[model samples]
Target: MDFLYLLKERFLPLSLMAIIPIISVILLIAIWKKKDQVSKMMLTFVTVISLILLISSLVLMLFTLVIGYNS
Candidate 1:
């Protein structure tokens, strides 16, 4: 039970970090399938933001991992 809690603590953030791009892609697909122009536009904006967040998070994670590995 304690190990499960520790595992969740370590993995949850990494999993969520990894899922950003996937969620963005799913959002983009949903937006594309939407027929309403306004809804599509809103989702497009969200997709862009999600992409930015995904990229930033990936870069940050990579840098941190490299630094930690070296140390």
Candidate 2:
């Protein structure tokens, strides 16, 4: 019961953090394989957006951790 509670609380932030790296890897691989300039540019844009999301998620996780700790 306690473990389940802990997992439930931490799952969202942790999963977000975990999934970004996988997405980034896939994006990078796609970018590597793609030959067209337009497609590459689009993939690059998406990659940048994913990186921004990852950073924001990290910030959110940290904020949550700090808030949880202080409270």
Candidate 3:
């Protein structure tokens, strides 16, 4: 089907975008379990980084959807 073909074409970028949320979830879980100030601070820093990544990924995805790729 046409939809399937389109999905295949966009799979790589979409999958890459998906990875950020998965990582963010794992980081959040780690943060919840962590207790020490030092470790918690470190995990918080990493979680912030993941948040930035998620935002950038969203922007990139939107841009790609609007502008599309060269055929």
Candidate 4:
């Protein structure tokens, strides 16, 4: 599928990067819901990890666009 190819082209990592925010949101809700598995420590960890991922993805996207990507 063409979608698979798109992911293969480095967007896979971007997708992963994007998912972190969603996960964070879920964790936030879980915290409010008093889920046993979701804790403040876990949220803090994921938040840091997501920040790193977001920055990396942004840098990569900028770099890719600068170099040019074939349609």
Name the top lDDT candidate: 3
lDDT by residue (tens digit), candidate 2, 1-71 = 85566556777666766676667667766776674655767877877876787677667666654454332
Candidate 3: segments with Cα more than 4 A from true spot: 1-9, 35-38
User: Model 4: runs farther than 4 Å from truth?
Assistant: 1-37, 68-71
lDDT of 3 by residue, 1-71 (tens): 85576567777787777777777777767776764655756877877887887788777776655456655
Please report, in order, the local distance difference test score of every candidate based on alpha carbons. Answer: 0.64, 0.66, 0.71, 0.60
lDDT of 1 by residue, 1-71 (tens): 85465445456455656776677667767776774665757876877886787788788555544442231
lDDT of 2: 0.66
Q: Write the per-residue lDDT of candidate 4 for residues 13-69, one digit (tens) a residue.
A: 556556655665665555556646667787677666656666665676556544535
Count backbone clashes in candidate 1: 0
Clashes of each: 0, 0, 0, 0
Q: lDDT score of model 3?
A: 0.71
Model 4 — which ten-residue stretch has the worst lDDT?
61-70
RMSD of each: 6.4, 5.0, 3.4, 6.5
Candidate 3 TM-score versus the reference: 0.58
Model 2, total clashes: 0
- Report the C-alpha displacement of residue 58, candidate 1, in angstroms: 1.8
Better of 1 and 3 by lDDT: 3
Between 1 and 4, whose lDDT is larger?
A: 1
Q: What are the runs in model 2 whose C-alpha is more than 4 Å off?
A: 1-25, 33-38, 69-71
Better of 3 and 4 by TM-score: 3
